[model samples]
Target: MSQDEPKAKETKRLVVIGGRGDRAAGTVWLVGAGPGDPELLTVKALKVLQTADVVVHDGLVSDEILDLAPSRARRISVAKRKSRHSYAQDDINRMLVAFAHDGLTVVRLKGGDPFIFGRGGEELEACREAGVACKVVPGVTSALAAAAGAGAPLTHRGSAQAVTFVTGHASTGQVPDLDWDSLAKANQTVVIYMGVSTAAGISARLIDAGRAASTPALIVENASRADERRIVTTLSGLPEAAAEVAGPALLIVGEAMALAQAGTAELVSHVEARGRERGAKS
Candidate 1:
């Protein structure tokens, strides 16, 4: 063949294989960052973060938890603070899809259990629709952490036979349309996540549905962390008691709340004494 014909053949070969470069595709991990403590992270979650190429974490994730990812990983903060949403759910979902499509290993880290009130289901559905390879890593939810922090057992032999977790807000940002009558039957623990803003309404609904106004209640804020706080009150005082709480809080209402109040008294007293001592020293 002539030299021109040989060059033409070589050009065609390069065009066919040049696009087949050894570029590694990426994946996304919908990892739960646990309640607030880094040590609460699951081994599998730590392993995923250690090698993640990119991390998109939520507002509640602690700084120590974010430190778990590789130093070279690109970290994106998509946190939604109180009254301020940095990124909407649809936007976050699209961002994850785009990151995965760009061939990067992404970790969508969230605080507490993703399935609880973290809107993880939405993100997971987005990934599925986009055909992105993704997996969910479960973490300790705030309900359990708050209960443990308050030294309360969610289920007691005779005090509580079941435990239910519910959100305070519906999709429309109003009080959820829950079966309040059934929930008022007692002998079960009810934990309300993100219910601080609606504490008064929830309390009213429960009492109207036959739950006693004298029912014990506890508000645990920043559960499982050093700055955790717990307030014990009656169902009628839930709204007022919750008003003093700051940061993400969980409300537990039931006979089990009585146990939490009694069990956590010593810890609360000790904490107070330490605070007093520090104040004196200062």
Candidate 2:
């Protein structure tokens, strides 16, 4: 082939490659990493992680889960702790949009189900406003994990007819101004996320609103992890019990909690053994 002919063919190939890159650039996926267990990740979420060009993840997400992503993927830790945010919500939203615009397949990996208090709704809205194509993949929330790990059934036939998951903190970092009366009378299982710091206030409000002080309550700390801890107490004791919970924890309160007695003793013993093993390893 003549020199000019070869050059023309090469130029056409470059243009096609550039067009393909442009076509694949503007997509984002909001994926849930589940409650501290990499194995809990959904197949779709795992596939997305494999193809992601960039992953922006939360603080509660496990490192093992992040390792599922392709080695070449750019990982960004935008994890937020109590009053400590590595990246503000607005900034994270902007970053996702900006990354997609740059032709990166962005993944916003959050702990638990993204829509469950993960600020994923706000991020989804941001993506919509920016005209970015986004998809959400749900994961197992910590409430469910905590209940399962503690051998508590969130909904028992004759005990709990429903279950409610609530956040203890508001945007101002204060106990949310929830309807205590309704919550107390609901008769369903109530799971409070991020309530460790506000356990005392939560217990007082529930009692003031007519909830039985003797209602069964359980606090599961570092749930689904090797060193997980479960503390069984009553509604009245939640405040004191929570004070001793050192790591990330979830609180479950309701009559259904009594069902925990079925196998909770064994589960607690297992957790204690795991804790000892971890301590020995350390």
Candidate 3:
């Protein structure tokens, strides 16, 4: 071999996990948008948002975070709130696949951790089936935000040995099928998402499963947001306490929740009054 023939030009080949004849496929990033605060976003999530060619986000993502993206990036809202859905789940999955096929970086942004009750698994499956590269960036879930905002510790030395996150609603908009017996165990905290509407049934089931009627329970609404509201009550008062909340709320049941910072006296009184009403009815 000749040593002076331009060193036989070394070619650097780019390898693509999934690519077409001449073009490499774009990647889809499933990013968690955090609870509600823009500042809560992970540094990598912020960078991905700023550089993505397209952002498909849920209702939980704040506008402030969206504004951080480049001005030219396209932003689409696929928010699903209770009974109303801006875009169907199937449509979103297809959309992500379609965007990646077009050789454009796509960001599928969800509120809280993408893997935690965010249907990120479904979307990730779709990407894999379509032969597209996908990456996940986790964000702090709302349960954590609720706990933080209320100054409550999800786990404590003697009060809570573990914590469980459960969805309150099923596909049928009914109480989700959860292991009530396990949740009723002591030294464990149970956090229910989208549980406001099913609080009555939840309270009844937990009580039937041996959870104490007087267990300290905290209902947090719009967690981490400026207009956050919290109601402190007992398991027996869950139904009435829930009736007083008109927004997205989380039901936290456990002894550790008793450490939550106290709310206004008026709110406390209201919770107590509702507890009394529920007791009178029983």
Candidate 4:
């Protein structure tokens, strides 16, 4: 517990693979790669990644993060886009389990927190069924990144008393069954993942369920990356705002979003203009 001990302490640096049972099987670590930013990776996740013999990552996981693994490590991308999956969930689970069974340390790198709509649960179940040891390393989900980028607090004492995360749609390309009634109540922030396509329907349902049409809304596209874009609007305008987003996006609604800043470029321009005017007057 000394500072020197802290400095000398090695992380979960397992260069050698070990597993349960009397076999040489390895373990599966579901590491969250964070929301597209390599620097956002946790220290533990980074250390585990260094020891990986194989990496199974999602499409959204940037190449920069993947490069952190030892150059000798094997990389397998199981990218999944809307309605297009290079490998089905079942297949991905099988791949992780199979890799671990071969005594190879496997890192299943996912963007954002794995459990948040990333289907980490299904994969964990598969590994348990196969008797493969598994561990999870948490990462900063996109919701936090998006909110931070906009300066919007997900829960504000005076405005947003609570926050909820919900998927935008189901596999059938339709709105998933959600408690729109509860969501319609004010004072709660609603962050919708993978919902840009069904933005119109989602807005209508919330409106019908008694949510205010003028609720402050924000659409963040490609959050936490260099190409990030933030659009601040209102609930009724969600459809139009979403129409401009072609990449992975999140739709956020709540009064707390009223404090959210507009795009960086516009804000910079506004500040610069004010500075010029003040200088001219002086």
Runs of candidate 4 with Cα error greater than 4 angstroms are 1-23, 264-282
Model 3 C-alpha lDDT per residue in residues 110-226, reported as the tens digit of each score? 999999999999999999998989999999999998898777899999999999999988889888889999999988899998999999999999999999999999998887776
Tens digit per residue, CA lDDT, model 4, 15-117: 1232334558898999999999788999999999999988888889988898888887877777888888767787678778877877889999999998998
Which wins on lDDT, candidate 3 or candidate 4? Answer: 4
lDDT of 3 at 22: 50
Cα displacement (angstroms), candidate 2, residue 237, comes to 0.2
Error of 4 at 171 (Å): 1.8
Those runs of model 2 whose alpha carbons end farther than 4 Å from true positions after fitting are 1-24, 261-282
- Give the C-alpha lDDT of model 4: 0.86
Q: Can you list the residue pairs that collide in candidate 3?
A: none
lDDT values for all models: 0.82, 0.81, 0.84, 0.86
All candidates in order of lDDT, best leading: 4, 3, 1, 2
Worst 10 residues of 2 by lDDT: 1-10
lDDT of 2 by residue, 1-282 (tens): 101112324433432343233555568899999988677788999998889877888877877888888887877777688888766677778778877877789889998999999888999999899888899999888888888877789999888898889998778877899988888974589999999999999999999999999999989887777777788899999999999988898888999887663224356677789999999999
- lDDT tens per residue, model 1, 202-257: 99999999999999999988888877778889889999998987788899999988
lDDT score, candidate 3, position 212: 94
Question: Could you list the CA RMSD of all candidates, in the order they appear?
Answer: 11.0, 10.1, 13.1, 8.5
Off by over 4 Å in 1: 1-24, 262-282
